[model samples]
Target: MSNIAYLGIFGPGPNSSAAIVSDNEIIAWAEEERFNRIKTSPNAYPAQSIAFCVKEARKLGLEVTSIGYAWDCNSYSELATANLEQTIAKYPSETDHISRLAQQGLNALYNPTKVKQDLGLILRKLGIELTDQNFKFYSHHLSHVASAIYTSGFDEAVVIVNDGVGEVASSSLVYVDKQGTMKELATEELPNTLGGFYATITEFLGFKAYVDEGKTMGLAAYGAPDADIMAVFDEMVQTDGKSFHYTVDPRFRYSGKRTFGSRFTDLMVEKLGPSRPADVSAMIAPYPAIAYAAQKKLEEVLFAQMKYAASLNLSKNICFAGGVHMNCKANGLLAESDLYENYFFQPAASDNGVCLGAAFLAKIDETGEIPKLPSLEHLYYGPSFTDDEIENVLKQCKLEYVKSDNIGRDVAQHIAKNDIVGWFQGRMEVGARALGGRSILANPLNPDARDHVNRHVKNREAWRPFCPSLKKESFQGYFDTVIDKSPFMIVATRIHKEFLDVLPSCIHVDGTVRPQTVNKDINPLYWSVMNEFEKITGQSIIVNTSFNVQGEPIVMRPEEAIRCFYGSGIDVLAIGSFLVKKGRR
Candidate 1:
């Protein structure tokens, strides 16, 4: 361990979360927004995030040897241009340079210089001197490929990673071996992504282009597709059911600026009809048929592409990571496809996993053997608060609390009784999906559980459905397929109709549900809750939601959870050894 050569550091966005890994194990991680809370400029770098990582590592008694930044974007401009030109020429435009988008300032958003300065500032804060060694830059798409392969636990797999854009490529297909050797089969660079097309559509619909595509995915479940719009989409993006692509016209909406406009809105309206205002609560199952249609089209193209990639390496398997893969619905489509016998999607499919992916890929090249100590289960990869640490905070606040003997089982009993319980166990989760560690638990079988949870802990829109976390054995009776074990809520599956009546709140109005299947092997604490719920209700499951109310990030710390609990109308709040009920203080 002392002779370890480097630490791989990756950030999904200059504005986003950071992750660090050594010897293929994640050591320290944090989101940039948590430390600053400003949602500020990426140009400022993630110094606060860096400081947390360094400080957290020091506590673990390990000095980071080498730091790896997730991108080598030196040729970003030239590459984006060439890729966009190809898309434009093949699509509606005829030009070499598509849009005159400027990324000069964007490049500096969370740049490497800022990271080093932030790292130095942290050491200085601890009264230590700066060192000559600095963070190293790794290629961006390669990080995506690495994340897909390394975490995938596949010796050989066909890796396909597609996102809006990376430092260099937008979509890359790599053939990888267990020994960590990767061969690139294809690279579809920027302005040529199907993902980008949806992003533009997202922006035109009055949402943030990059951040709001999930909204589009959600919206798509409601509408039917416009035949004409589908035709245009198909015309621009050509797919042979193996290789799929669309060339983006640089003009009209090229610069990644003017993220919203009436022109594209009018174009979509001209083809797909007017866009529906997203009153998330009132949307009928088929009301937004256009969204459904678009989703169907996107899945058709994406599934074909996956099959194509699978066909590329019939002898190997398939693995993936990227923003587009976050579409659990699309993943269901691909997972059900006959192209690959096995599937793995990076839990942090978005940019956040790039750091660990890049670092792990580099590490694999160094030792050719995986270190088996740290597993990727549960993603308890962020900061943790100790009993003493939490105790001091409660003492400082002069708040009274109950110290429970068995935190997991005691809380599980409350949930089994159909009580909504706010649970804060250990380290904060790193990715988008909240897996038990920082979550609210409730009875999934209670048809009114959704309404109660919404009215109480979440205040979520009615049209939005609550997902469930089920114990492993109990899944078979409620769900049609438990073979995949989608513990991350990545794939939304249709529940058995007979059981839907029993768990209406857990089942979407459409009869589909996304569930996290918890086994003792995956999450022991989460499993305890499910097991207890079964002992009481004759079923083992609970409705789970990210542990924050509407319009807030998931509460990360004990204090945040405590504050939110008091602020909102929550029933119970449990943090580590302490328990607080409504006004229990």
Candidate 2:
């Protein structure tokens, strides 16, 4: 293994993160939101995340010799300026407005020298320093691709990256051969993005763009096919079945004054009626149908792209990254299809994963080859607390708690009793999903469990469905699907008809569920709790959601867990080995 250590920084935007790669392995990875307690941590510098990575790297006797940033600011500046100029030329009347918007957007794109200065400030704050020569800026889509392909454990694979404009490309298809050679096969440039199309609809439907696209995904299941809505969406994004390219109509996305407005234009409001009010219930007729149409269109275009990628037959294995791939419903369809013999989805497929991707790119740049690495097993790559540390927090808070002789059994018993539990175990998960590391656990059999948690704890949309964390062995029995393992909860599958009534809370209105199959060896404590729950209730599944209240990031420390336990409707706080309980709900 090479002795060189590389530090990677993702963004000063949403889902900012940092990672350290050394000795051909990821030493640490974390998102800024987890440390800042802000959802997505937009515009945050990720200083805390970098500090954590540095501390973790030090434990392994490693020091960061170089740094990699996820974006090539120079390329982005040139492309963005050109795109803006073309837009202004197309609509001469809105030149001033378009130019102002473009200036604001361009100013926000990372400037290499400014980024180096910012990094120097952050490093100095952390009692470390590095020269400007150590920094390298890579293309955004390349980082997204690297994050998936390098950790996919596949010698060869076709990688598809789709997101809201990375540099100039919104979607890219790259072929990775056995020789580790990467070839950019096809790309869909800006203004023709699947992510932009979805985000536009997401904002129109009264949900925050980017942040609440998943809410739209969940609402889509409740919506039936609507001809008018589907037609409108069809007009917005046109896909060619024979090719990997698609065109998004600018009028519905970022055209004229709409670029400075709510992303969607007046034409969209005229076609679909005025945007849904934030206070209004999303369950209303046209809104759900709108979400459904948008989702279907996204899937349609995505499947076309994937099918084209497969037509090349560069490799049977396929890997996906970028924010758009976070749509588990689409991922589920890809998983069920015979398009690929094997599939790997990066858990942190969003910009948060770019840090790790940049770090890998730095390593490759240094070594001149992609390093062979094991497939990413679990996302327990964030901070972890010891029992002693947890106990100290408990004592400081003056909270009554008991150290469990068997935490798994104890937590399972509470869950069996229909109690919502905050299960804070080892390291926190790195992605949007909590997995088992930092999750709220509940009995899946209780039909009201979903509503109870949403009303009292999550404080979000009641129609949104909760996911299930099931034992790996029980996957085939509960879900009818060809794909066997989905450890990250990034794919949706249909629940078996017979078990529908048995695990009511876990299944969505469409009878589909996003499940995380827990391997015993990968997450022993989590597996043990499910195992014990099975022993008690004859069911090996539990409803698992991220351990956080509405509008907050998941808990990262014992204090945060304790605060969440007391602040919300969660019944028990099973943090580390200590169990703190409240009066039965």
Question: Candidate 1, TM-score vs. the true structure?
Answer: 0.87
Which digits, one per residue and each the tens of the lDDT, describe model 1 over residues 174-267?
A: 8876555678887776656656766766765545566656666766665666666557566545666656444544343353223235324334
Model 2 Cα lDDT, one tens digit per residue, 114-189 = 7778888998876667675677889899899889998999988999999998877999999888877789999988
Worst 10 residues of 2 by lDDT: 87-96
The C-alpha RMSD of each candidate to the native structure, in angstroms, is 3.9, 1.6
TM-score of each: 0.87, 0.97
Weakest 10 consecutive residues of candidate 1 by summed lDDT: 93-102
Off by over 4 Å in 1: 2-5, 11-15, 38-44, 81-101, 108-134, 204-206, 225-229, 246-266, 273-287, 364-375, 583-585
Residue 422 local lDDT, model 1: 87
CA-lDDT, candidates in order: 0.66, 0.88
Candidate 2 regions with alpha-carbon error over 4 angstroms:
1-3, 91-99, 258-261
